[model samples]
Target: MFSTILVPIDLAEPESSHRALDAAFHMAHEYNSDVHVMTVVPDFGMSIVGGYFPEGFEQKALDGTRQRLDEYLEGAVPDNVDVKGHVAHGSIYEEILRVAKEVGADVIVMASHRPAMRDYLIGPNAARVVRHATQSVLVVRD
Candidate 1:
């Protein structure tokens, strides 16, 4: 049984994320748990990329992502579900794992795409999360 559930999605590509979110909600409902819907914005860690953007880009990005996440969940999650939205900036998998720990999530439900050679080389976020997560992770393929 889970107390807190973490559902991570890619806002840019939410093709199959809905499936994972639905599953998480179902589980949360069954267990009387709260769902934490989270998404990560890629950090402009490199100085070169940071220089290309204007000042306060990171804050702007976080704010924009927060708004988008709210809008996204408005239609995606049902009103009855006890849900919270979170935005993080950094590596996708790392942020997800961090949020899971931060929220004391007992389970993480996420979506994954079909593997390609490039994905195997660099590894996908879902794969990384599966490997690194301290709690249970259910990966639903897109």
Candidate 2:
């Protein structure tokens, strides 16, 4: 059983996040674990690229994500479980791993729209985590 699990939510795909969150919440309940929900922004990429975007771009993006997560959590997350939402700036997979480490997650719970050839190779964010993460992973398919 997992003591800590990380669930990465794509704000843009808020509607689809429920399935992932639900699965994570179920697992968390089974193990009495905490769920760490996160959304990754592309700001880290822009900063690394060393360029300024239009005014309010970053804030707008962050705000949008906050709205998405808030909207999704209205009736999703459980009261008995611990849930934390974070907004990070960087690659989704990398940020996911970083948060998993920071939260000391024993298992990483996530979702994938589909698996293609790319996934068979380097794979998606979930796949990458499965390959690199020292802990276990539970990937929900949609």
Candidate 3:
């Protein structure tokens, strides 16, 4: 029985998260839980990389991502569901974990893509979250 369900999705590839979202919704409906949908805007990682972009680009990116997250949930989430949206800027998995802790999420439901050779080397966000998160994680395959 979950009190809060956190779902992290990539807005650029929302289709991948459909299964995960559905699972989260089902759980939320069953337990009368709150659903928190979150999206992360990856940071440049270095100040030099940030310099390549124009001024105010970071703020614009965050603002745009927030707007997109809102618009996305408007159609994706059911009217009956109690849902909240979060837009974070940083390492994808870290942001997700931070939000999960911040929101006191009981579990995290997320999508995982088929692993490519590169994923083995660097690992995927879902994998990282599963390894690092203190909360229970359910990874729904895309």
Which candidate has the top score in TM-score? 3
In model 3, which range of ten residues has the least summed lDDT?
A: 11-20
Q: What is the lDDT of residue 39 in candidate 2?
A: 82
lDDT (Cα, tens digit) per residue for candidate 1, span 3-97: 99999998887778799998998898899998999999988777798998899988998999999999999989888987899999898899999
**Which residue pairs show collisions in model 3?**
none
What local lDDT does model 1 show for residue 24? 93
- Order of models, best TM-score first: 3, 1, 2
| Model 1 poorest ten-residue lDDT run | 10-19
- Evaluated with lDDT, which candidate comes out highest? 3
Model 3 clash count equals 0
- Candidate 1, clashing residue pairs? none
Per-residue alpha-carbon lDDT of model 2 for 21-61, expressed as tens digits? 98898888888887889888865454655455676777888
In lDDT terms, how accurate is model 1?
0.91
Q: After aligning candidate 3 to the native by TM-score, how far in Å is the CA of 47 from where it should be?
A: 1.2
- Tell me how far the alpha carbon of residue 105 in candidate 3 is from the true structure, in angstroms, after superposition: 0.6
lDDT of 3 by residue, 21-63 (tens): 9999999989989899999999999888999999999999999
